[model samples]
Target: MIIIHSLRFLIGLALLLVLTLPLQAQEARVTTARVEERVIVETIALNGSVTAPRTAQLSSDVEGRITELPMSLGDRVQAGDRLLSIDAEDVALQVRSADADVGEARAALENARRRLREGNRLGEGRNIASSELSQRETDVAIAEAALERRRAARDRLEVRLERHHLRAPFGGRLTHHDVAIGEWATPGTPLLTLIDLEHLTLEFAVPLDLHHRLDQAELEVRLPAGIDDWLPARPIADVPLEDGASRQFLLRAMLDDPPTMLPGMAVQGRLLLRNGSGPAVPRDALIRRPDGSISVWLAREEDGEWRATERRVTPGASHAGRVAIQQGIEADDRVVLRGNERLEEGQRLILDDE
Candidate 1:
């Protein structure tokens, strides 16, 4: 009876070991990376839009019927290029009449001067009276004043004639044009909209708290729909005043040789803050738990087998898929980069490379 009972106990122990060995020796396939000491520049994500330095709604300064529309919608124009021409026949006729009056005035002034010279010679010979010479001098003064008045009138008429043609104020592209030949254009009426695409900028509404950090931060921007590569940018100026509705402030930056971009296009920005350096690992190594605590799985070698160890870490700045470890991990420590999602403490790891 004793032998049978002992044999039964040994068999039960063997069965229990068989059941647990498979579970204990199970290995999790994973990939690993070593922590590196790098210059980690922290950054804040920003939402912004592309904008041009100059956008204008051009209009005619004078009222007239449009006789010539040199530029149409989507046309590029240079500074001083004629955009529209008005009917200037009436104004040109008035200028011509003024020019004739100026010529007549000059002739009258020359005649008056000749009479005054003769009068002075006659008075020196005592042949003309003093009162007569005084009258001659007064006539010359009146004639000279008449010439100046006529010239002033001609200059005014010439300016009016020039205003009949509207020229571009700056180099840009016409975005809006609705006027046609024989259409009546009046002052203060928008004829076309012009936008300068060469000098493009970016405008962002940033939180007020980050205003102080802008002085030392470098900016990088990318157009979400157009360019995927990040481009460097420099801060132009800030409004300094806050927007009451959004609780944010306006910040503008100039792009460095940006690709083709249009105003109002959405752009993403990263304001890089170069504060310090620390040990970092690929972003995939991070594991966020349900309790709002962040941790990482570190692979440690023990007894010639690689095992996973749960480590709580304080993460700082991140850039380019790598995150700086503020606390808990050391440089050169092996971190499980891939296949760490379901890892358990002290679980054996089967490295993919092996």
Candidate 2:
């Protein structure tokens, strides 16, 4: 009976090893990546609308009812393009009155000279008194002063009437329309918003920790895709003041181009840094757990089989698709570049493309 019991126990142990062998030898399905060292950082993508390089709200310098609108909104206007015209009836009447006054003054001055000429001909012995001649001269001077005052007033009104004929400040397209043909556009009323689309700009931000990186390289900004090709870009002058919450700096870059650009366009660009060679991996290579922690899988060679080990990583500056690993991984450690989710510790993998 003892020999039979020992034989059954031995058979049961052999069967257990058969089942465990297949389980231990199972291949791990995973994606592999070459190890590279690169300067990396996580970044915050900022979204903003495009804005005109210069926005001018057209308004009337003199109060008047608009008799005509020569250009409508969205119309391209050149410098000195007439936009609006005010009623010139009152101003024209004033100018005529001023001209009449000048004529009357001229007549009075001529009459005064005639009196003086007659008196001079009579000489000191004549009945004409010197005081009387002086009185006539004074009357002529007074008439001249009155006429000059009227002329000055007329000229001042003429300027206001000229202002009623609005013109474009620069050659550009009109973006807004706040007035109509017969609208009573009073002084300080906005007539339209003009934009010069030739010059474009992009406003973005850089983190405080990574702010020093931008200063290290001659970075060039570019408009993403739709705007235009061959658009030139420039860096910002000063970093924005720190936000107490995020501790970041905002930057505004203007794109100088040949003709001009429109406002509110999508833009994507890279900010070159002084960083040397470093690992640039797909931003998704790192696993972000529900605990709000970031990590990367380090593939270790154990017993001639690839093993994936999770390591916590601190990420730094990021732009486009790649992220920078700040800590937890080394220059030559194999990382599961793609399909790392199915990996388990001590699992075996056959590098598909290897």
Candidate 3:
């Protein structure tokens, strides 16, 4: 009878212990997205600036005092238009002197030629000595050389006179004008800044890794403040030289139909490379770890329960809030989009249906 009582007491204690034990903890709620296969064209973004295709700083080619400056800042000018004029009085005087010298030389040449011709005729008649005829020929040759020298000097003087007036090298708008009437102008002194807006280019420095791909890619430019849409551009130049410090190569593109764009405006450039099909996931699913590596939380079934699995991935270009997974993750995989920050390796998860 004692044994039976003891057995009943033990059974009661077992029941109490079973009731006191804690039940399995509820699964944490999470939002998940299925990885999808998509066609993604990789793109590279580069910062650039708008620049004129042609720009020049007009400088004085002759030393003189400024006499005429018809164009001012913001003035539109055509090629060969007079931008600034310096006093050409001294150069003009030199030109006149040179002209006088050339005329004198020509007269001397003509006289020498006439004498030589007469001497030749006299020699033919045996009335002039051979030595005298030779001397006359020598005089004619000397006169011809002197005439050439004088004419060359006169041409140089005329060119100098023209240089006293600075002309526009191309059609452009003047942005700077530093010369004034009566201002002393010296050779190589900058007087005006001209920029051609009709042919504008977008310039950028891209990493050397993209040097080969630049030609094959389609480029677009986005002006931050002026234009609302991306402007299509074609690669104009890609300099092979690279910056030593940045390891970047210079690239320039011509805009197809730029609108109201100006030089020096900041712009963003996009280079779209070849189209590729790949698995893509929501951008929010990506997590950047402290070590600067990117990863995503994957919900995997284990022991008949959904558990979070950390996956290391290589991320490519992003579009429409979705990022292309270059590696590590595949299509049809459940990727946790929300409530993943607190996820742990193999931790149980409850999917949110809403």
Candidate 4:
């Protein structure tokens, strides 16, 4: 009976010792950082194409056989440089004929004026009859009208002669030419294509919602096909019309110091939108759930222990490696940066030393 009592006493002592032992701590080792309010500049990426500011397909104004083509394809020309010359031989001959006619008319006019003066002098002394003087005056008037007609004809021929040579209207590179020496060039026929390469314009399209942000932002352009660096750009204008199908608007800008960028080259543009100050956290702290929601594991002090609490957050633009938290998180909040994927709600946390 004494042995049985001693066994019961030993069992009771063991139970008391187990009940008095402290529970194992449920703690997770994690890296943490304090959320900070920073001035975040968001960027919108857009694809576009590079284009020449001025492009033209030059055509002949007069019909003639091509006599001389001084500027060939891919030739650089300054403004007023002669690109093509049609056969001006016939036109030149016509101008000369007109000039001779003008000279003849002037000589005849002078002879008529001399006769009129002589007749007037004779009439003053009654040596010439009134009818004779009237006839001389009419001859002078006819000669004056003939002279005017000849002068007008000569001017017209000279103007036609000027059209035989096709001159460059602006300084540009000749990109195309179809007319060759001895080829017949008809009026309105395309002769060459000119493009001004000094000034280049980048054409892009963006959504309407970002119009306000783009207006106040700085823009940079990357020509994916030609240039390797991002070039600074200045906004020129936006087309007042919107694309009905895409629901987007067209924008144009001039690239500063562009390098060998040609028309129709594909480009990517970055618009930096300054969105003031906001609470930002490391991108590693963000957790994307299966429900298509984004949340973060925040370290909160609960019952004298730091615990991980999952909070749904509204994320804004991201810059560098950090994300802007627009809502559900505040500045100075401790967020789990590492080991967040294994974190559970209300799980005890042991923050790593910085």
Candidate 5:
């Protein structure tokens, strides 16, 4: 009878222990606040080069030895400013020859008129045929045509001679120099490279896959590292064709205020995705698989265990490393952070400080 009583007491104690162990397990794990909110996701993070709106390679129009170089690289100039002067000795000689020809032609034309008039006045008796008078008139016409031709040639030479002194076509700064004070400049030689940097450009490339996002965009440019504020711009131009290698379309924009922006400086911007609502998550939450697959582990209550389950997520833009969750888990979902290594489908996880 004593043995039977002992067996009964042991069985009761085992039942009590088994009933309390689950509560202990529940106390061991941690819980996080489940908060949900609407998020507007945007796609805009892209890289591009800082550039100018207009660039020109000024060329020499006249062939001559450069006698003066008044402009240097980075020198600001205005329209019609004497950029450089070439020795015009040869051009001047041509001009003089042309002028002399014009004078001789004019004299010949005058003399022919006088001869025709004298013939008509003195030979009125008989020797001067009507045909001879008509011939004289034709000779005068020929002289007049030759004079006009000489005058035209003179004007052309004068225009060429004016080009010997290179002048600025527009207001710009000299960004290069190819001629010295005594260097020979061939016609069409690049003499200077000019750029207008005041109103500058930020030509950026957008991947063709993302072209839809930017195709109708009003751009917003920002350089978080260089500038404190976002710079908005109106769209300017684009390359209709996508780059075969990079599959990106190039674009340009004019800044609202660009007198302060410097050209060729490092800059980055995001094309505004007029659609202003999308979800986002910390970039660190993304788990890149060995095969280059991407996934995330979500902590959830399942089968009475606070465990992590892998979920494949489609990620989008990343701004300052904060990734936009275009398609994946909803907001306020607890994801494994530090304990991702121990994470598995239905594997128990406890946030250290949850």
Candidate 6:
């Protein structure tokens, strides 16, 4: 009877212990995500600026007084549109004079040819001397030569007249207008500055050591307006020349489909250098410790029960809010994304999805 009473007291103490324990001590709710295997690439952030493919200083090829200064700063123009016109009256008169000379030369040539034709006909009937016919033919040749010279002179004057008008070589906007109407324009002196807006390039000064990796890396650019999307860019030019002072080289890249951005606008870019592939998880799942170690909590299923396990991980390059796990994890592993901070080893896991 004493042994039975002792057994009943022990059973009561066991029941009391179970009721006194907190419900949280048994299981905790957690949010988890499956690990994904993907390619991991290292990225180098860069600060750069936008630049147009063509920026030209428009100027006249001939010396003259500016007669028409039609374009102002910020005027968009098409190719071959005249921006400035020089006083072309003198050239126009010269062209007219050359035209008259060509006409006289042509009339003289026609008369000479008629005489040569008459001499040839008389020579064929043995009525003209061979020396005389030859002389007539020589006259025709000399007149033809004179006509060609006059026509060449006329064409040259017309070209000079065209040069009096300064036209845009490409479609662009005028960034600067330095010359004014009635200003004495000289050859090679810039009158305006034009920047091509159709094609743009992103310019970056990258470290010399990483220059070689630019070809293997993918490039992207973003504007300074706090936009989230990155524009895809490709390397257009890598100047092999390096700056001695900065130890950097120029890298010019172009976007596949670029937004409207002004030249010289500040931009940001990144060079993504792919190294290898590995399992990755959301960044939230990572727990950084003060001791410079990184860890993650994982949910494991065994015997129809879920439990939590803390595992130390070696993190690699992170991209798109996910970090590649170089070690201590596998693809399809259930990583605790939320409530991982308060987790303890061997604790029961009640998944939020459940």
Rank by lDDT, descending? Answer: 6, 1, 4, 3, 5, 2
Q: Work out candidate 5's RMSD over C-alphas.
A: 10.7
Models ranked on TM-score: 6, 1, 4, 3, 5, 2
Report how far off residue 47 is in candidate 1 (Å).
2.1
Tens-digit lDDT track of model 2 for 1-354:
999999999999999999899776656666767656665433334443356657789888877778988888799988899878877788878778777877877787777778777777765676787788787778768767776876787788778668879888888889888777677878787888888766555766556776666666443444555544434457655456756587877666765552334577655545556445566556667888899998888778888776778888887666556776667776777777776776666667766546
Per-candidate alpha-carbon RMSD to the true structure: 7.2, 10.0, 11.7, 9.3, 10.7, 5.5
> What is the clash count for each candidate, in the order shown?
0, 15, 0, 0, 4, 0
Deviating ranges (above 4 Å) for candidate 3: 1-38, 205-216, 224-226, 237-250, 256-260, 279-354
Q: Could you give candidate 5's per-residue lDDT for residues 26-119 as a string of tens digits?
A: 4324333332333444556767767876778887887778898877888988888998888888878999999999999999999999989977
Query: Can you tell me which runs of candidate 4 are displaced by over 4 Å?
Result: 1-32, 40-42, 95-156, 212-214, 226-229, 242-245, 274-276, 298-310, 336-353
Give the per-residue lDDT digits (tens) of candidate 1, residues 1-354: 999999999999999999998876678899998899998788888999988789989788789899998888899999899999989999999999999999999999999999999999998899999999999999999999999999999999999999998888889999988889989999999988889888988988888888888888888988876467989998889885544777778889997777888888998988888877789999999999999999999999999999999999999999989999999999999999888989989999988855
How many Å off is the CA of 47 in candidate 2? 3.0
Task: Tell me the lDDT of model 5 at 95.
Answer: 99
Weakest 10 consecutive residues of candidate 4 by summed lDDT: 18-27
**Range of the 10 consecutive residues with the lowest summed lDDT in candidate 3:** 19-28
Instruction: Give the winner by lDDT: 2 or 5.
Output: 5
TM-score of 3: 0.64
- Cα TM-score of candidate 4: 0.68
Clashing pairs in 5: 40-277, 40-278, 41-277, 41-278
Q: Which candidate is the best by TM-score?
A: 6
The predicted structure with the larger lDDT, 2 or 4, is 4
